[model samples]
Target: MERLLAPVKAFLHGETPSSWIEEARRPERLAVVLQDHLLCELKAAQTAVWLLRRYALDKGGSERLKGWLRPFEDRVYRPCLVKEHQAMASEVTPAGLSCRPDAPLAGPLVEKMVRLIKEELHHFEQVRTLMLARGIVIEPIRASRYAASLMQLVRSGDPWVLVDRLIIGAYIEARSCERFAALAPHMDEEVQRFYVSLLRSEARHYQDYLALAQMASPEPIDARVREIGEAEWRLIAEPDALFRFHSGVPSAL
Candidate 1:
């Protein structure tokens, strides 16, 4: 546990608040937390797809991504049977998706984004299965302010916009990794194992986003990274009314 804390501590600007964990550990709240986590994984994949389509891929690539998500989107757009979601999730694979060689940062961006989407979707499937086993209905909740607030800092330009997005992605991933590590010990056996299992991929996702940011940027992004990191810290450390998976301390509490 001490060893795990090292990387998680360095990854985020601030720790997951103790108040947040206290609330998260309650049995009454577990379902909501897990459901939010399950969908948050999908949201991460959507963000990756958006980045790929917006900056890394051509029209064909974008269309292929749509096809890839068609199955899971149906599950979220409207309530579907659990078996239907399972079957559709089972069919998600990156076999047919390939990067076009003609775009900016095409190779690294496509490669990493594709891998991220694959893993994130896989995680979504895993979480859904866990939810099913626990008799929790998979419901689509509205997104929290965590991601949107971070994205508000994104500038308006070509590579500049992409650079900021990538930086934001890094912060998001890093915070996810930190949260998993921080909350793992407080979770039940099944949930704890699941959270711990996610640490490696989340850690890699942060690094991949940072690497992509550097690749997309004209110059060094250390200063920009620090700037975004601080913003992320504020979001984590401050009070929030909504208590989704990545939210800060609950205001009402």
Candidate 2:
């Protein structure tokens, strides 16, 4: 815990305002935050699935990948497709995942990615359970601009391909961790507890993604990480049109 606190303390000192914590702890804000939180988990799972399919797997493997997510996508992921009062009670399990020749990936990369997918899916379920308990209806909202903006910077082809994707993943995980820390203190006890519990996992996920990026690429990752980190910091600090979990400082919406 001390090791975790070292970085988080530095992060909080540098990026978060003191008053923000007070504002975040209010019980009145939990519903809105939780709604965003739930959506964020879905998006995380979706992002991991997309990355694995695009970079690590072959066509047949990708189809199998999509199959793993199809049930959730059909039921819980796209909220607009289902009745407001109705929720899917069954859970989908991903099975028989293995590397393919057309896009052979390293074992460690595959293992880490598959584990992340499972964790993200589990988190999606947890968020759904919280929403059900709180009577927070799941609705499709327009995605925040954070991801699209970062993706626009991805260089086309080969080495850049892996580097850019991994950089984006790091940014996403970092931002999610930042927001969880930012919002947790101001939330109701239940929500605060949940968000606080999430801090360690999210922090580790960011590191894991960054480490994988470094391992996959021959180029030095530090400079790339620094460059992307600066860009991410701008996205977070600047005014924005939306207020999804990863969105920048809320504009007048």
Candidate 3:
């Protein structure tokens, strides 16, 4: 944990605010925390699929990937589709991930992202199961501005575009890892254990994204990283109207 924290701590510009942690740990807010956590897991996998579709896969591969994700989206968006797609939840298989021969860094990108997609889907299922056991229903909420705000800071065009996306991915994963570690002690036993279990992969996801960004870029990324890290810090440190899992400090505080 010490070794992992060194890079992640340096990578992000700020810690999860004390006020947000207080809000997250409140008994009345557990449902909101779990609900947003569950949806973020889904969004992470969907983003992985999108990356593969745009940068790695060919036309046919992209279509097939979309077909594969339809059921998951259906289940997520509509409560009625949950039972129908429940069986498919446990069936995430990266058995047939195909990448374009001409795609840059094809093998590494596909391998890392496919694994990420599978793990994220599995995590999604776990969260949903826990929700069901607690009689909590999955409801859609407006997304927190954190991710889109990070994306806005990414530079426009070419290798920089790709590098910026990768860097942003790293920041997101790092923040999630940090937040999980921060929140664990305050949660119920099951939730605490789940968050603890998540730290390892979440840390790795940040590393993989950064490594991929370096591979994809021809120039140094240190300055860009620091610049974006500051943006991430501001996003987390600011007051917010909504209090989703990844949201900033609660306004009521």
Candidate 4:
């Protein structure tokens, strides 16, 4: 476990301070943070779905992919679920649709992506449960700039495109894990424990995304990973225009 989590520890504890966690645990702040947390988890799951559907799955499979997200989408965004709890509530068990991985592309990419999708979905459910326990009302908010900024670095070609996307994925997972660790110290016992527990799985998700990126391209992925890593650091460290979960230091709204 130590070996598996070494990178995660280094990333989280290196620059992040102990005080941030202290602030995040306040009950007064819990509702706002939980709202952001809920959206972030859903976005993470959405991102995985987009990746697999765009790169690995066929057209027919991709349509099914949209169907898989329909339940949550309908309830939260579409207003079609009817029941009050179902309409405005989030699920405690993150939901996901199974993919048909037998066709077209077959490799570790498929395996890793599918596993990632499952984990992300589970994280979504966990966050939703936390929100429910706290009575944090669910509402839609615009996305943070973190993802868009990272994606701007993607190259304009096949292998490079895929490689860049994977590197971005690595950074996203790594940053999420890092933030969780940073914020855990300030959190209440329950939230703190949850964040700590997420470190291992989140660490694996980062590595898995990087490994897949390397597999997809013939070029060495290190330099590109480093480039993207620097970009990610800036995104986290610099001032931002939004306060969504992955947004940089909170800016004045």
lDDT of each: 0.83, 0.67, 0.84, 0.69
| Residue-by-residue lDDT tens digits, candidate 2, 146-215 | 8888888888887788778887887787667776776765666777787777778788777778888887
Ranking by lDDT: 3, 1, 4, 2
Error of 2 at 105 (Å): 3.5
Off by over 4 Å in 2: 8-14, 17-29, 77-95, 102-104
Candidate 2 vs candidate 4, lDDT winner: 4
Best by lDDT: 3
The numbered model that scores best in TM-score is 3
The TM-scores of all predictions, comma-separated, are 0.92, 0.83, 0.93, 0.82
**lDDT of candidate 4 over 123-171, digit per residue (tens):** 6667877877877777776778989988999999887888898888887
Task: Give the TM-score (vs. native) of candidate 2.
Answer: 0.83
Model 4 misplaced regions, further than 4 Å:
1-5, 9-14, 17-26, 79-105, 251-253
C-alpha root-mean-square deviation, each candidate: 2.1, 3.6, 1.8, 4.2
Which order, best to worst by TM-score? Answer: 3, 1, 2, 4
Consecutive 10-residue window with the lowest summed lDDT within model 1: 81-90
Worst 10 residues of 4 by lDDT: 87-96
What is candidate 3's CA lDDT for residue 166? 91
Candidate 3: tens digits of C-alpha lDDT, residues 155-252: 77778888999999999999999999989999999999998888889999999999998998998889888888888888899898888888898896
